[model samples]
Target: MADTPQNQAALALQMYLDTSASPLGSALQRAPMMNIGIDEGELATLPLVSEALTGSQRLRATHAQDLALTVDVEPDPARHALVWQMQMAQTGEQPGPRVHNFRPLHIALDGSLAPDLVIHTWRGGAQQSFFPPDAITPERHVLYPRTTAFYQDGTFTIGTHGGRSSDQYMPYMLITTADDSGGLWVALGWSGNWQARFVKPRGTSDLHLTIQIEPCDLRLPSGTTLQGPAMALGLYEGDAAVGYNALRSWLRSHMPALPSSDLSHFNTWTAMDANVDETRLLDAVEQVAGNGLHYFMLDAGWYPSPPNDFYSGVGNWRVDETKFPRGLEVVAERVRQRGMEMGLWFEPERAYHTTELATQHPEWLLRVPGREHALVNFALPDVRAYFRTFIADLVQRLGLRWLKWDFNIDPLPYWQQANDGGLAHLGHINGLWETFDWLRSTFPELTIENCASGGNRLDWALFSRAHVNFANDQYTNPDCIRRILGRMGTFLPTERLNMIYGPFQRREYDDAAWQVLEGSSFGVSEPIDNWTGQFRTSLRHHLALHRATDAYRSGHFYQLTPDTDDLCAWEGWQLHDPETGSGVLALWRSASPEEQVSLHVREIDETRSYRITDLYHQSGSQTVRGQQLIHGLTVGLARDAATLWTYHLVDGEENQ
Candidate 1:
């Protein structure tokens, strides 16, 4: 019989070695990249590692030299859509990059993407099998779109579609090898975010996604990469909390509402508060109402006991009766009473080593016959059914308006531990796909937030229903600019902006705000918790900037410079009146610290004279012709402050 796809991949890895003779053989033997091409046989299979992403899952990350690219490969009868990935090891000491999802990368057939076919038991993990719908809605999140995928019908199509952008950087790693017989195995890889793990199978939420690292891989040129599932960079979205009413109420209440769509504005939720008592829970709700937050969330630890320990009885999804004596009703009621919306927390897939969720539904837990990384498997159809019912019921009972969904652990060994296929990582991620469908279909009104410990699992696909990606930043130093981009920008668009923004401290505004919000909005975990001088200025400035300019809040987006030092980087957003041809311009400077920064603006109508005012800084106006503005503007900034400029078109009649 002809060699099976699995055998072909094994052979490919062997050949890859003879051709490249990479010295990193040991590492390759561990986590190799996969590839496909003319040979079709030269694919690499990743050796099964005992350890899964035990501590924290990674989202997208890019640092000095360390690069990681992940692509998704869907299976086919005749062939497969090859996807691959590259992850740079931590280079710098300063929290390198806490990336959650790798950017979505595109590749061609000439040994591009990864190869295809090599399952732990039956074609990777079953998770690779799930897919989501295309439409966007509250039901469909913006940050965690499960349907995000890439494809190729045939090898010829790869070239026919314009093969090899050889000129660019795939500068990551190569994944393909030759067999002793000279044939190459076709091994392709891809990744995604998950709602629940199928490692050992928890509940009946049959959702899964698989990412095969492969047995061997080649290093491509720098910048070489693949776009995979974006579960890693989860950001928190809208809340109506900052000011209730999803409609124009808040804007009308505040000022002449800017004529712009909600490109940012991810609502707020009570983030990461381990409320073990009813009083604490109520306080958290009041806190959400007290602040101007709209999307109030109750993060991990609200269930019963420690959160990370999902299998324990304490980790049950049910509200701790003791703490939530009145159940979620009070919490939701309080949030609504405060004119704020609310979202509850849950980790259904991860049953704790001591919890009723686990004890009663032990069958749901995934277990690799001989491993310690036991987990739940979402591949089992029965499990998916359970999840659907559980979540749907919660939505109905709690009057839950929002959902703060979480996946706190990395799941590799969990799959192996699940025993079902020993491919639970690949299998359980399926839950992500199913979860997206069921969650949206079941609770169409509820907003979901896909979070894997902040931005760890943040990515593009999750956007299907998750409007926001939680970038916890883990309270990292506020001064690190790279932290912002590395965690949030890899896959998202301008729509996820207002979903960012946060409590800015004057002392750390230079370090935190500048780099932290390069691609996101002004989201704050503790908006009014601590108010001081610098914090006050930073907060006021952020509000002024976000509120005044359409770009940061909602407008045509632009990234003027690469992320680097010495060269001041900038992001410009222009809001033009389609009819009047007038609007505001906002800019963010990330270069060197200076009192004055200058830039040439683009897309301005030179013929029309304009009046520009510093929204946050000047509160005044200066008459400058369009020519000077478009070429860039030279403005003074506080040490590490932001500047908002409003360009009011000259009303010929008024001016005269």
Candidate 2:
């Protein structure tokens, strides 16, 4: 048998020996077992730990320690990309001096590998500059929010942003040749502030790609070891879609399987906001369960009141006795009685000075000395232990099956001042991972949704631990939802996407909205308790579609059309399950007054016939040859309308 790509890329640590490190007084500097290359033609060397500099000024990193690394190569036959990952840590016995930027992995590619290779990189994220709820809804809001911008270039340029808090950075890149034949998809697995720069020098065909953590500011106690984020690079063949599917597969292989049963949820934040109480919540849960929602969440306001907003009472984590005279358990029991699981919303990492945790243990908060709001300090072991116990008790006591965890503040400045500021920052991040490990291990039945003010903390590291993410907080606009759904699945699986549904101006836009929901972890914010007859019927219809097509969420996602800035242009994506020869396509025609366009769907085998059913168009199912479906499908829209088309091979050939 031929040597597989997995075997071809795997190498022993001896191959990555840093012989030159002997001068540094250590030969075991090769502690990190590293590997490189997708094939024999291109190989990667172990990372060279060195001082970081900016404009000739060397970073003031004093505490020097040993670097620990682990590299792995896992190749999937169905995926076009060959996956490679690098994980590193710093082992130290004393406090470090100043904050420093350390590069943990580097890939040096020779020009001879692929002549005229075209390097393509996207900003990965667009900063969320959302409009207030009262603002007039234009035919569209920013289809691509300021926080989620994408860019591509060939030269070495710096595109950096603060992660999670101010900007939602997506550390992803696609590198392919000029012909789009061969390339790699790079995914930065870090959730906190990190940066990536694509450097292509003037003279050589050599490409240098570096992945590094934001800072090394921790003052490590004796014998302490701090680990950094992991990085995955997948090699693929063919076009952008090919690379996208490959990256999806690589992530799927690494992601832990969450609940496979019904996960459709209804959260109250968008609908009720801060005006919520037990009576309202119990009513909402009853209605949500009746309308086919599987999970009911009482978001934000259940805590003690500042009356102004939910932000002030964070960290209190208490159900106001006045609001819920019987306590939160009453609502949880109501939801359970209605046949729905219960979920609670929490901003566990941020707190107001007045809250219990902040007032009782001032030392537990990390913040700029004069800041009013406290950044829940994860650097404290006591704090992490408290959260572990708190969460475990809450879930077990309330019989809660889901938790919506959110982070709404930036703690970079506070972390920079921590015990060993640089290393302190790393410790805070590591603390979150440790907390998650405890939760996952202790409460295997609970599902956690990662929401850093909506999709900011999205990456493989968090995704491997959390079940889903909020794509955006501004869920009212159809255009924005359609655009996000089109691109997000390229980086994350659709099933793991918590697609928020809201009230748009036209009921017609609901189909496009539900298509996005059907393709992911669908959630709605509506007056569920008092739903109308028409609304109840509509909810049931889409809920059924979600159940039937949910399996395809683990399949490959392909962007059939390029994302657009034009108000009238259409954007669409396909989620394909090759094993089943079935898929779902979500196509949207934004206010582009143009009524219709010809869409060419891909991935269907030509010899087969498929039955394409228009779920929203209610146009019914039509059997068409795969050749015709892939060639051209004339789809028309009325103004800002959308369509959800589910297609599967008609004959037994699908399984054959």
Q: Which candidate is the best by lDDT?
A: 2
Q: Pairing residues by index, what is the TM-score of model 1?
A: 0.55
Task: Please provide TM-scores, in order, for all candidate models, with all chains considered together.
Answer: 0.55, 0.82
User: Model 2, which residues run further than 4 Å from truth?
Assistant: 1-101, 124-160, 165-168, 217-219, 419-421, 504-509, 528-530, 617-619, 651-656
Error of 2 at 591 (Å): 3.8
Q: Write the per-residue lDDT of candidate 1 for residues 526-633, one digit (tens) a residue.
A: 433443456546555564455455343332233333333333444343444434445555445545455555665544687677787765447577777777777766
Model 1 poorest ten-residue lDDT run: 158-167
Local accuracy of candidate 2 as per-residue lDDT tens digits, 1-656: 22222231233222332222212112111222223221121123322332223211111111234434343444343443333344333455553233244554455444444445455544333333342221111121111111222352234532224445214336666656555665666776666766655544455444556665655533345455555666565555567667767777777777766864677888888768778888788767756777778888778888896665888888887679988899889888988899888898888888888889889988888767777787887767899988887888889889989888888776666665564545556667778878877777788888888887676677777878887767666576656666666567775677877866766443433565666675567788865434667777877888887777787777878776666556567767787888998988777776677677777777888798888888765657788788876898777777656777888888754321
Positional deviation of residue 252's Cα in model 2 after best superposition, in angstroms: 1.2
C-alpha local distance difference test of each model: 0.39, 0.63
Q: For all candidates, what are the clash counts?
A: 199, 17
